[model samples]
Target chain A: MKHRTFFWFFLPTGLAMFLFIALPIVSVVTQSVFAPHEAVLKTVENCTPLVGCTTETTIDQEATREIREAQPLGRFVGLDIYLDRGHLAIAELGEAWDTAETWGDFWDRLFNLPLYRALAFTLTFTFIVTPMLIVVGLMIALAVNSLHRHLKGLMIFFSLLPMIVTPLIGSLILFWMVDSRGIIGSALVGLAGDPNFSLKASTGLTWVMLIVYGIWHSAPFAFVVFYAGLQTLPKDQIEAAQIDGATRWQQIKYVVVPHLMPLVTFVALIQLMDNFRVFEPVVGFNASAHATSLSWIIFNDLGGETRQLSAASATSVLTIIGVAILLSPVLVRTWRDFKGK
Target chain B: MASKAQRRPLGLSILIYGFVGLWFILAAFPFFWTLWGSFKVELDFFSIANWTNAITGERTKATYDSAFTGAAYHGAWVQEEFWRNVINTFMVCFFVVLTSLTIGTLGGYALSRSGYRYTFWLLITALIFRAMPPITLVAGYLLPFFEWNVWGILPTTIIVLVAINQPFTLWMLHSFFQNIPKELDESAKVDGCTQFQAFRHVIVPVMWPGVITTGLFSFLLAYNDFAVTAMLLSESNRTMVPAIAAFLGTTYTEGNVMFAVAAVVSATAPLFILVMFFQRQIVSGLTAGAVKG
Candidate 1:
């Protein structure tokens, strides 16, 4: 029988996407509204003693800290998943915001600390990584493109090999390389005068390492696409540019870059959408390194006991929004530029 | 492989080689190290032993056997009984490829020949699914699938990989179909053949290159993916990449023989054959869809 004869063929793919990809996100968004019903808040009350704290404000502060420094085995109280309902204002006019007893005893805890913080972090990570990748990728592409044909092909293939290795493998290489006895380990000890030197766990260094790793993982395809685009440019125009006595830099900047603009725009937007869901490499190394992206947070929650599917789903929703927002500027630019083209 | 006559000066060649050499090392260091580690004992791994050490030396079958045979290297060296895994890997790849090819081909045919605006919608979904992070899917819905026992390993993996791949494969094969001239199909129809028969005989044979290209790539995705298969497979049925990943992710020190084993399965053995046998076709296959500007 013909496949299209069944309604399932056409319907299943779309249905699956909606049921899985979009539904999780929608449920997550609705979770912000579902907030936490009264009974769910009981888990948070239990959490208070689990993490030591005497007063309400201190407890809230401590809870916020715990959420931020989320252990792999962290308890998944559904309430702390929301944003800054930590303060709990009692003296507001009506009965909307007043919570006199516990941090979880909230009627209106929409978007608490962890939720917003993760969203912000995910956005920031995406913002930084995307542009860095584009710039670095273009530079490498240009350099590789200028080489002789034989040299260029070999160089390109070697350079692109990183894209094939799994992020888990890549991160393990990083962990081993930068570990004390590994390549950087002995070198770091020789230079920094300490045997125990792990650049991965250090705060700002982690961000830098992640961006480097992300670029290392990603930039090859961009280089390949840009190279392909460059290769496809009309040879007559290049010959004409040379005949007209344009310098190499002038030819590259004016003609080559313009010619590759469409490819650049496509890569930029794709990378923007793709980078938001950063998880594997971060978790591959350690849970603490999972700080910069929300996907990692969702994965972190999913692995824990309560498994906070509701909160993780909600986080995925915000992550979806964050991805849309991240892409909006690039997308709008692409639309305009593409239309102009 | 073509050596063009425009040879640069020797000094510039060194500079280019030096720069590219460092970058390649950086890119390939992990794979190289994994290969090395896969042969060395855990004890030998920590210590800077003799020059033939697994850290930076030739990884061979003898080293692998020693790692397995001898229990003196810190702890007993980890060896995945390779033959069962080899069979399991074949089953996973074969089912994944077969399933993806069927859906992708049918879907691609519909999208290309259907001549509807919905094809564009299908195209968009394909791009998004292709671009969507694999790790996101694993944590997001795969867990739910596993918990519910909705589908077992072979069925579930085949389903997931096909769904994930259908959009891209369809997208890939659409252009291949478009390249086939409509006149042949029209001529066949004019001679009394139906649309389905015309496609099977006339269109498919002509688009053999497209089928081969898309099929190989779909196979690559199936073979290369760890994130999807990691969440899906238990110890009883791990794919090549995820099986190797277990060595790295574990708490105890294990011998690196698994890395060589994985490299052999995932990249070394099959790819070596594929590349050697059909290098030109494989290159064109990748370049046709992916190398486009």
Candidate 2:
């Protein structure tokens, strides 16, 4: 294809991405370094008859409005927002480090910061969910592969339901089921023999609930991909392994898994990216009091009466950085593959 | 393939069946349970007195004189005017899929045909964009959209979603186009057809399988999205997912949790139909990227 034709063909999609995806990234970075304008204050002196002369400082609303109108991007604070307590919290980190008596104490203080707390949960969720889902998915694929032909289709159709449903709605369904008065919650109460044993009341149980939801939601995606990979498996390799007197487990370990290794990597890469953005489940589970993710933090900031754009932008920038880091391995491998080709 | 040596033992077969059955229940029970519960009143659905009330709808029978009721659905769809949000969701999904596929096919075709290093970089850029959570972009959009008075509207949200949908769409279609032996279009060009003509006449004729697969995914992305729609749309123009979320906030306080339950079930019904029809396309589309890699 000629450069001109290629240009024309690619122009619409490219322009859309540039304006929405590329430009917003730049906008987010810029907004992160800037803070919304502070209220303009003025002092007024009131002299009462033989009583007192008082000077009161009040917000000059008119001046503040004019300044904000003039510069809607707000004033540039140059990383002040990034370093503030709501974000990186450099000063708080230093205080925690200096005043802490032990490593556990120091760790507790670090987790108290909003950004670090969110980072901890996001990373924990990502790392935990990705591997567990892959295992569960592989198990389901193998089990389904061994089923009769008529049952395979039915199993797959049912399997896709959890993944195909909207993330928030799926989580909500699980959330309601696990409510204190709901079936699962009442069953747990019976098991524990404690009427007041609520899953939502404890941080540990809430985290477990979210992680279980994550696996339940995403495992089907893995199963579908692996099931497809299983369809293309070579018969000769498995037969050869069988002829060598290999057991079922050994045949799978040596022949099946090696063949599906690339697919495993592919599933891992996709799931990593998907899991890192774990926001909706947090919202649906209403687990923000016990657990928060980076995406959830940004959502919380952007919401409500405040609409704290600067804080949200800072967190957005940080989240992007986290994604870039998480993605570096895949990006490097892709670059290598392209160069080799 | 199921020869004597490959046959599973009775014990193993039983184990596999047990595991798969358990999984089947785990994967599907919640939706059916929620669907069943959505028809009952709040007390029976979340019964503190007796758990069996959820199944039998004891309180529901006492109040509505029926084991099942459409009262919740009526409350959600009529009293809350959730139909407006449902209409908005379909409108957004329709435009987002249409625009995404239209532009994506062209760009994807261009990338597949052009033998240049820049094509590689463009895809990589798209991969990066795809990885960034859409909420991160919301912060950037709020200031500008509010300033321009374009925030909280369906059209703006549609365009944003289409843009977000581009990267994955391009990658999917790009790979799909590559599989369509270049000879088809090249032969057309040899017969005096222009490049555009070749694409329009030859390539387009055979591209429906790929295009339909890609379109299914685009529709899913636009339909399943909560972040962009929830933030970008106004109260009057809210989509079903966000509307349900909003329902939780109001209905909980009003002791009308059944409204939210019905709304959730209603919102999920379309997705259930979608999966029922397009299961094959969805599975193939999912494996398309992984298999190629």
* DockQ metric for all predictions: 0.28, 0.90
DockQ, candidate 2, comes to 0.90
- The docking category that best describes candidate 2 is high
TM-score of 2: 0.99
TM-score, per-candidate, Cα-based: 0.74, 0.99
Clashes of 2: 0
Model 1, position A175: C-alpha lDDT score? 61
Worst 10 residues of 1 chain B by lDDT: B69-78
- Pairs with backbone N, CA or C atoms under 3 Å apart (clashes), candidate 2: none
Chain B alone: TM-score in each candidate? 0.76, 0.98
lDDT of 2 by residue, B144-238 (tens): 99989999999999999999999999999999999999999999999999889999999999999999999988988888899888899999999
> TM-score of model 1, chain A?
0.70
